[model samples]
Target: MDLPSDTPAASRTPRPARVAVVTGSDSGIGRATAVRLASQGMDIGITWHTDEEGAHRTAEEVRAHGRRAALARTDLSRLPDAAGVVEDLARELGRIDVLVNNAGTGTATPFVDMEYETVREVIDVDLIGPFLCGQVAARRMIRQGDGGCIVNVTSVHEHQPRVGAAPYCAAKGGLGLLTQVMALELAEHGIRVNAVAPGEIATPMTGQEDEDVRRTSRPGVPLGRPGDAREVAAVIAFLASEESSYVTGASWAVDGGMLRMGPQAGSHLESDAWRRP
Candidate 1:
């Protein structure tokens, strides 16, 4: 956490504008977050894996809010190289004030039957990817001498494990701890870090793209329905904004009370179907 020769120990000056880079922003939670942050007056940097069209759509939405939007193709599996998207976006946006580590992948295979390559890919994309990207964003924020924030998009599995998603659970669990460590180490540099864990959201990853969440029902959840991507985005927006300046090293669960229904879920299961993917 060494500061640049010209960088001050801390900066108290007000900024004229803010910029944010959200990875995996081509759709779902990432797209919603980019749009929400844009509406809050922050220029957005969006990244896509395989959906250039979706990334452009996100950019259009950001521009509609009167904020600038920059696009890049971010393949987390590419490792150290892919993390450079943050630096590229920061340069394009002039400066970065926020970074949402939203890009991730997961596996549904059971631990015993999983392939090493598949596990490696999942961990690389979900855990190490965010680690490197967070470093890139944080170093720039330090050099800029401005206090900033980073929001790591973990999952509900970060706190609890699923039977068939051994690798997914492991990566998310690792990310949850990584968020805390980053928060602790970066506080002196004025960079706050936190994690947001989402439950079953109406996202393409959940096979519910553009689906109305209100029409869905989850008997085990107190809210009784899947959450909308916008709902998760709202929490991420809070973490990225100054409104949550004092909050760090915490994990916010946007799970419709599903995490609290652990024991109930266990007791109410009618069959062993829950044991498989």
Candidate 2:
């Protein structure tokens, strides 16, 4: 069992721990994702736009799981450069193996009443931010000469429209397509790109922080309850892990059958006149 004298010393050394950058991880699904990945042994880079306290708490949780966690402040709405946070995190964590574009914002104003700035902000946070972050992470992965994973935390709105979520829906829809394109282009470099579309999760975004989804009732959801951030994080972890090595360019719906109700509910309506008359 003696090693050959010609064997390089570097080959005898263990590979560095994998690192993951989870943006908007100050709370909710992002926080859950950071912790989940950490549980899977990834050193985490946690980012927050406005929730510094929450980000620190998430970092603590990641560390509690015996993983290193780096913290950063990132505002995706700043665009074109917001992605620099990824590089910053990579620098702090030594290397980047995964990038989770989980940061986003939205407005409920009607389309006609929506201010230009509001729409622009939504697009900048949801679409442009992921685009830039993906680009930066991909380039770093390519340079490192190792495969990587990018998971974009899209929403159920990506495929289905909500009454007051014009900007949110549009931005998520765009990110879905962008995920596919990134997968196609980065496949050559062994980078896997995918999107996770979450339904009504019991997160701060839904005004249900720390609430147990099992106790809450969601009549619209087929499961009769909202999802948990951890539930969505589990899927994200899968996508970010070697378990999904063959999976890319796909949008996995972590919804509780919420997306399936749309067509069924519409078809059950007694009036066909609204369809096309």
Candidate 3:
């Protein structure tokens, strides 16, 4: 068949693999997601806060899959400035196809005892950071005239409350709603937005990095064990790929049925047996 006389050169050529920017890819779910996306043939942009070495290791893993990898240091607490890292990665990688807002922080202090600065920092990193980063990535995708995907890594706390996690819950809850709004608005541009809420994942945050989740136990959870980072990454990979092209504005809970337990988790527990399943 003959081509149109005015067909653009770029569109006439074969398209390259997608490129993805994953924040806090130095470890845990972030690292797992980056590698998983790479295995699917997408180039990855990795961000680290304080763990440069870990980020480099993640980049190496991406390269091991024969995908390109770029590195950047992102301090979500730094505000609007830190969000620019998304643009930086897009420049280095040639284009932006996906953005995973996985960088986060939390507080374990009692609500009443928490200092103003502490609350501000948590909200800044967990909520505002993803918000701004999404904006940067979305604008670029719009300019390129291609749809994109943004996955915000919220937590089970986004829906449920933990006694000492006031700020964390508030930020995650806000991000959850933001995902829906972004989905509604960006759908016209072929973009999709969604949230991934995890519970008791075996990550460094939970002091269970590299721990075999099968050997561990969680009595309150329906699955009777903590989740592995790879499990959460698999879900993220789906959302970031064409596999979930029709899905958006939704929250997928990758918690071993912990959310289903509800009040029964507490009411049914008896004695020391409550510590293990």
Candidate 4:
């Protein structure tokens, strides 16, 4: 029996792709994660809900790091939108070696006055969206017979409740537990699941520079400053790398000491230099 003289050498197996799909990657933490992963040698797949220009900027940075960047528009509140994102990423970049469920929604409204729709939407985006993407990514990774990592971009709200973010708190809390549950279930298959809970990081979503959110936010953090997106991305990069191979089912906080900051932070740090005049 003879075969064709040449069949493109079986497509070269695509260099054994290592790619990450980071949701809400157009700005802030998501964008930072995409860039970091690229720097660390993983092709990046980014999704943006509203920040198309920012997403493109991130893609350019990811590309600059010498890795393929697949960018898309995603609205996690829509179930179909959430589920399809991972599939699209895998199709575009060969295979998904890492999945970062980073997109989310938050509101500063009191729980009692909150409409049911508001809470539902947050839960859908922050919690359900991650679950769907994880399920899809795990299936693909398993079929490829190569284990991978799934990092959920949760919030400090997962462990410490915020005053007015009822829905955000609820969704992140669920994500915390869900991360552990998936870790337990997927360990047998060699897949790892973990979470990154960030505190008051400066991001487009928070619009912390918008004067209002900024003034009200300073008093809440012990570091006396909001975190930068790059710091959070560094942690995510560690979680996705082979260096952290022994780590899984863990929730790491990148929140400039915010979660541990108690109500007494005001007593420790004095602002006698400037008054709210």
Winning model by TM-score:
1
Full-model lDDT, candidate 1: 0.93
lDDT of 4 by residue, 1-277 (tens): 2234455777645457589999888888888899999998889999998879989999999999898998888787788566798999899998999999998889888767899999888999999999999999999989978689999989988997777788899999999999999999998788999999998777777675223333454655666677878889999999898788888999999877887766565467566532221
Per-residue lDDT of model 2, residues 24-115, tens digit only = 99999999999999998999999898889999999999999999999989888787878899999999889999999999987766677888
On residues 1-277, what C-alpha lDDT tens digit does candidate 1 reach at each position? 3334565648645556799999999999999999999999999999999999999999999999999999999899898899999999999889999999998887777779999999888999999999999999999999999789999999999999998888889999999999999999999998999999999999989899999888987888899999999999999999987778789999999999999998888998899998898
Query: 2 or 4: which has the higher TM-score?
Result: 2
Superposed model 1: Cα runs more than 4 Å off: 1-14
Minimum summed lDDT over a 10-residue window in model 1 is located at 1-10
TM-score of each: 0.94, 0.92, 0.93, 0.86
Can you give the lDDT of residue 93 in candidate 1?
Answer: 88
- Residue 121 CA displacement from its true place in model 1, Å: 0.7
Best by lDDT: 3
Winner on lDDT (1 vs 2): 1
What is the alpha-carbon RMSD of candidate 3 to the true structure? 4.1
* Poorest 10 consecutive residues by lDDT, candidate 3: 268-277
Give me the displacement of residue 118 in model 1, in angstroms: 0.7
Q: Which regions of candidate 3 are displaced past 4 Å?
A: 1-12, 269-277
lDDT of each: 0.93, 0.90, 0.95, 0.86
